[model samples]
Target: PAGDGKVTTPTGVTASKVTSGAVVLNWQPSTLTTGDGPIAYKVWSNGQLVATSMGTSVAVSSLLPGQNYTFSVQGYSGTHASAQSAPVSTTTAAAPAQKPVRSAYFDQWGIYENAYYPKNVDTSGAAGKLDVIHYAFANIDPTKLTCFEAVKASDSANESNPNAGDGAGDAYADYQSDYNSGTSVDGSADTWEQPLKGNFNQLRQLKAKYPNLRFTISIGGWTYSKYFSDAAATDASRKTFVSSCIDMFLKGNLPTGVAGDASGGAASAAGIFDGVDIDWEYPGSAGGHTGNHYSPADKQNYTLLLKEFRTQLDALGAAQGKRYILSAALPSGQDKIAQLETDKIGAYLDYADVMSYDMHGSWDAKGPTNHQDPLHDSPADPTTPIAPGTRKYNVDTTLAAYTTGLPEYGIPGGFPANKIVLGIPFYWRGWTGVPAGSNYGLYQSATGPTAAKPLSQEAGLAAWKELNPPAAQTHWDPVTESSWFYDGTNFWTGDTPQAVQARGAYAKSKGLGGLFAFSLENDDASGTMLNSMDGSLR
Candidate 1:
């Protein structure tokens, strides 16, 4: 078909399998002619004008499968059309289907209390809906066996002298004595020789009641973090500690000498833990005295520990014919950015829960009775220019610290979608000396600071409820998205329905695993805050 006008096709269309019903078409650009001003091209399929193009190539979609179609291109200038290019034939193939979405949840020490058990532990009725349960082992001390005895003694002593200056000290001493005694608190039997007993017992109970529930054992909190460095310092110690932990966690047995009794240890541990959770307050740095004080070797060794743990767990699962999960609790402050080896650790973990609370409050200079975790900007800093007193502990900053700082340190998935679990606080912090109507103020006590009114000075969920009832006064902080009330002399702060919903919404927007409140006991009796959280998440 010789014609005066020139014909051209889009450049770089190589023949390759894309999908069953679609085929890509490409060709080279046409040589510019002096008289042909801005040539236009027309694409044809089986002699039908499928597309008219001023430039090169287009993806042809929605074609009949197994049907052969002839494609050709023709150039045009104004009203005149050129001869068609050589016809190219292609057959349509079938397209591949998309993958289905999977769901997951974070259990932040949820299984610690057996809400589904005999005492009707949880008044909120959230146990049935929970998919994962986090079982905590925070008070375990490797140096002692009678820890429970000490705890019981401490409780008894505190009750004896309510006004004693060292009442708290007496309680701590009793706790240590119990740990050393290796005897149960009730004196009925021997204390558990392994670390996984109490938590595992609760987990076993929960799983028996809810067959579909999963359990993860979280280790290392603010108080027990001091031992991590010492345990991970040398290869021998690391191996010993890691081996003992896994043996106890996976098989319910203590590793060698560490266990007082070895015969039934493996079987007991295997019956409880479905996964291991690492809650190292901070690695490669010191936190509490219990922390091991990690060094440069810790950066690499931590990764090694996770890898070995994963490998061992996988092997155990294959042996037991069941799958096990691994996860960690990451630190929230910006200062922890440089300490962790993110990529290696992230590779081994199924997910990580960031403890996003304790961000601000009396810890800071000015007192503001607000939500410890806010979704809005920091209202206190005018130069930074954020929503005044908005949710200061919002998802934005938390996500940024993890995704940006972590990956920069060779840690992958810092911004991993659906792999992060946002933490919600069941309590609130309040301050005193706050100016009235100034959007921020202090939370004072009723007896003018000197009175032993209600509870201790420290703000806790239980204390707040007793001191300030909803009927007495309405507590509200628009900027911080929190609430508080004053009983004439004392100012108090506490969690409410509004704050809980805000936390759930933030988790939803970020595609996170879910939301986890610190302790279920902190919620109101009718499950007001818990119900609000569940509804918001759903």
Candidate 2:
């Protein structure tokens, strides 16, 4: 019992990370005799004991923003308590001017032709502003009917193959491919010994640099969603598919490299993805890419599939002590939304990201060169012979279809507004052979999509940074909250910087979850659109 009341004073105490609501205070373990049983730590804030920790660090949370505080540590062994360590003073960050769920989609193929690497997420300043990055995409196994990460792409050319997504993935770009100093996030060339490489490795680095940011592996897309219906068809299939996804992405059991490369193995990409984003395109409808399987049962089955995912993810999270996220890219068309149990599925999702863009594009190709991503409908627009997307094809109306229960149209039960994420397209849809009208090609007859040289990244489309229309005539439609440009014959429907900022303000005004770019790479090098979105949201 001699000197039982005294222990070694804690040392090397410091505040490692300070934020608006929390401070991460860390200290070295005290040196003492083995007789000191069951050592512990006590955190003192402003000279008062605030918390007891079994570890060397404590996250002192729920503090006032922009306030200064002093943190110290004391070691404990049984009834003995060490003298308090020297206090270290620090200030919590000022309150952030934005909300959570600020997300952006990262296209892995950007490395192929667009030269957009994960490093761009950093240099563009998008990483700092974004809290979530949905990496698009991780493909589903065609034969296995499960989530897969491989290097074999069915259509290597990446042309007009509707089934290009089946069993197709870029493991090369995901992890195996090497990043030179110029292309890497940390400006370090990847060596052979490193287990990870390429975009995925860059993502890991970005995650380290931006501790607040999280990366989610987006499963399926317009091009890669061919098998969602089959995968989510029944209970057995859904269980297998979700488990495979958890194994491949959430668990990171990636393939051991593509073809004959031996640089990769299981768990090579573990801890990279924070969750999964289901981009199934459409559930019960025969929409999206060709040969997509759909059935009348998909309506109920879709909700069931999501429940399976939520149940499994929660189980895994409980075991791992982490809350993994689950979200989906909701169909914008009212008809497509009808096939989804929107009201029910929202309960299983962190947020439902509405594909609000591409409302009108060259895909119509019939006549009117229209706004592809209007925020509202124009009263002067054609009112007769309306189709699903022909009318009410705007951000406001599409989101309304989910949150307001369009009873007149038969879709019932509304989703929560706070759980919706708006989509912002970083690319423009163009058309040519348009007869000049008072609306600058809008609501005017057009022959077809533009014959002009399209952006190499996609066909009949132009990236936001590559829009050029002969010094172009520009116009904005205040009624619809849309903007575009034309040069006599070429018409391109795109969003302006102000338009993007307005959308951000619109999200805040409506109490929406957050905003996401269709693909961050298409934005200008200045990240003007993303910055505008963040600035207004703030």
TM-score of each: 0.59, 0.81
Q: What tens-digit string does per-residue lDDT give for candidate 2 at 367-480? A: 677887778777877634235334466677677778887665567747899989988888888888888887777788777887544344444588888883333477888888
lDDT of 1 by residue, 1-538 (tens): 3546443333343433434544455566554444544554555565445434333443343344566666776665544456677777777654344211111222222222322221122224655555455554433334421011112211211323322211111111111111211222111221333222232343343443444445665665554454565566666666666666665555544332222222122233343556777776677765323323557676677777677668777776554434577877776654453466654576788777777766655544344344455555544533222233222244465576566543333333344646777666655554555445443233321222222333333333233233435654645555556555554433445556766676677778767767665555444446565566677677
**Residue 70 C-alpha lDDT in model 1:** 69
Show where candidate 1 strays beyond 4 Å: 1-123, 138-199, 254-266, 286-297, 363-370, 381-394, 405-413, 440-494
lDDT of 1: 0.48
